[model samples]
Target: MTAKLWIDSDVCMSSGRCVADLPRVFRFDDEEIAELVPDADIDAEFDAHRDLLVAAVRNCPAGAIHLQEDGVEVEA
Candidate 1:
């Protein structure tokens, strides 16, 4: 019912776009891939900043960002 953010670490190129756009919601792990903030729920945050998240995803060079709801991918 709502778009939730996630990153495919395997596909991420460590470009830091997501972290640059939204450091509060994204981080770089030890492996240098983009990762979500620990213990955070994207579905909950999506309501307030859906547009921002979409923009971040769109800017990802590696196309590693994804949005899903109910296990189905959502079109940004």
Candidate 2:
């Protein structure tokens, strides 16, 4: 397991960049805003889509997404 990921909604621009990069890991709610799949455990899910997760973070213009490992910061 690597790290968990979280997106700060307050800083999110609703760009959907993360959603587009990782459709299986992200989604857009009815409001057309980006949202993580409920209860997602990114550390466990990392192996399958780490690339996409990284890509999402890289693509996010607001820089709202963050990754943490065992409660330690991994990405800002």
Clashes of 2: 0
Which stretches of candidate 2 lie above 4 Å from their native place? 39-41
State residue 36's C-alpha deviation in candidate 2, in Å: 0.6
Q: Write the per-residue lDDT of candidate 2 for residues 1-76, one digit (tens) a residue.
A: 6677877877888988788777766787787767788867676578776777777777789988887656776553
Q: List the pairs of residues colliding in candidate 1.
A: none
lDDT tens readout by residue for model 1, 1-76: 5666788888999988789888889999988888999976677678777777878877888888987766777553
lDDT of each: 0.81, 0.75
Residue 2, model 2, lDDT: 60
For candidate 2, report its TM-score.
Answer: 0.76
- Window of ten residues with lowest summed lDDT in model 2: 67-76
Best by lDDT: 1
